[model samples]
Target: MFFTLPLSAATISAIGGSTWSNTPPALGPSWDGNPPGTAVDILSGQVDEYLLSGGVPGMFSFSAGTYNVTLLTEVAGYAGSNQLGWAPLSNLATFNPIFDGPDSPIMKQTIAPLEGWAFVINTGGGDVFSSSSIDRFLAMRSAGSTNGWSVGVEDLRSPTDYDFNDQIISVEAVPEPTTSLLMGTALIGLALLRKRYTKR
Candidate 1:
């Protein structure tokens, strides 16, 4: 799937300084409690509902697909304000990874685990801008023993006022129909052989 999440004013203030100004309003709080930890789910319909209910500025979109995301990179910029900036928090891993403001541009030199979560941080501000929100959009896919991909986002800013107009894209590989057919054939042959052996 594909999703676009715009940063909120509160998120900006949290990352950027209050003096940064040009902060957008806050978007309504709508997130699914999934992906474990603090990762929140910000689906499209939910965002629309929040907007209709008088939510804040900034918008995002998500699409569903069967692919594996081994790498994740954040666009360079502050979600709410220009003063602060968004940075990577940790290297991607199978377990829950935390991205704090202290670790900006958290880059992973190796390939990420087959399954897990990664977090980002907003830094460069103090006090009122200290908190952060968990804005997330997730996509999951799996077939038998193989694990696909799951992605999430955490705003890390307070409520009250913020913007959430950011974009996230996942790149992965999809199994071809031929590969699926071959696997299916192999399974069928194995089942037939087992049945014959049992009869014998």
Candidate 2:
């Protein structure tokens, strides 16, 4: 018999910041997607590199039109051919997307700074293996530009109070030894019980 467990929140927190160190240079437009700002651009290429460099995790924040946010997932290489070196989006059994913003039909007003909300991506699937959190916000296209829309990403795993613009956090991955030991002991005991029952 084999058993697998969803990683504990503590464990995920422990391995949260390791990816920042190996993150390549900024990929594209800055957080605003107009001109390069202090914030780094987290393009699909960057995500691919992060995964390839081992199971390192990092966070990126950007502000763009709501429609552009979907484009990130639709990027040809981002979701295809095991691009990120992680499970494909289609393979994801569940997603818990959290949108932090106001309640309004207008995309711009809905994503104000002080308001936000969270929702499950696919509730009908009824699978527990996968999940995601998406944070949305509205910002000007440029410092003075009037254009604005909801923009955010599906964060897989992250530390408490994770933010994209301010600083990129990375966590080192550490294998859980105690969990492994407990699992091994349980397996051995089960095997012994089966043998004794067969002999009887």
Candidate 3:
């Protein structure tokens, strides 16, 4: 005879596409697309790299558009003290804080027309790590959307577990009808060009 017990949320390391500690905290509104426990590829053994939107690692930007950011969860030792912010490309000195600990669990913010930007996570005690530095975060696409992403953070450096569940957030770039039409036209043009070239 064999005995098996079902797993509780506390026994899992990830849930709803975010990582968790032994005793997971309450998460925010569900962001559809990437389901929980899906395997998202990040650089092996590198927690500070981001490869989203076909952009350079550690930095990302969408075409002119407004985007929504949602705070998903915070499971770090400093969950009540850490902060999340954004800065212009390569400009850590001007990082602006948008979300902080002890705020609403489902807090949301809107950013407009970003071209060049990097995300940073600020842990207390003067520890601030930027995406550009390749030292404290991971960013990946949100399942199938072209402009949606999920970012996870480790928050600490001393005993970096690389679980990336310490802090998690979702970014979604709102699509414009005009932009969609233009993209369709451009894609058609490229297809025509490719067809002509192939015929030759």
Candidate 4:
């Protein structure tokens, strides 16, 4: 089965000193808990809910198959005053042993265990798909990273706001029909064998 996750995120603080989304607004809070210890389910694709936080990377398990991921939306601001226009977070995060077949121009890299790497957001949406320009290489404990986002996604900001919604990603794993058919055939054979034994 394929997984689908729809979420939003923001990184980087305003040029001037300010705080935006510091507190979960009336609209709602993305990161359920406190900073630096955000939940990892945001990318699990197991839930069909809107994810609004990203700090601690999740340990997502997947089988061998092409996964189609997309950036739903992205926004940045400070106290809702110096808010930047919300736009489609057109960023692409390609992992090693994987390729952005659709966005060929986009860049992809392999993440080592204990490595600290995160998905970067390109507000301009220019080759956000491409990793031409990237920041620090981080890792996740889930993937054997030396550490995880302890401060949360605050590092994305100059002062480090815990919004952690700069870039929301949804990954859908392609279905394998051949594998399903083989399993079905095996089950049928087992059932027939059981019936024969019962007759004896």
Candidate-wise lDDT, in order:
0.29, 0.26, 0.52, 0.29
Give the C-alpha lDDT of model 1: 0.29
TM-score of each: 0.25, 0.22, 0.55, 0.28
lDDT string, candidate 4, 10-93, tens digits: 112111122222222212144433321222223333222221224222222222233344433223332122111112223124
User: RMSD of each candidate?
Assistant: 15.1, 17.5, 16.2, 14.4
* Candidate 4: 10-residue stretch with minimal lDDT: 7-16
Question: Model 2 over residues 1-200: C-alpha lDDT tens digits?
Answer: 44544323211111213232334333323333333222224332233232111321232222211211112222111122111111223434333232222211211111111111121222122321212322211111222212221122222232322222222212112223357867897989999999999999
Model 3 misplaced regions, further than 4 Å: 1-64, 125-130, 142-144, 177-200
**Model 2, which residues run further than 4 Å from truth?**
1-9, 13-24, 30-38, 41-91, 100-200
Per-residue CA lDDT of candidate 3, range 54-122, in tens? 222233333335668888766566788888887664455676777888775578998763445556777
| Count of steric clashes across candidates, in order | 41, 12, 1, 15
Which one wins by lDDT: 3 or 4?
Answer: 3
Name the candidate that leads on TM-score. Answer: 3
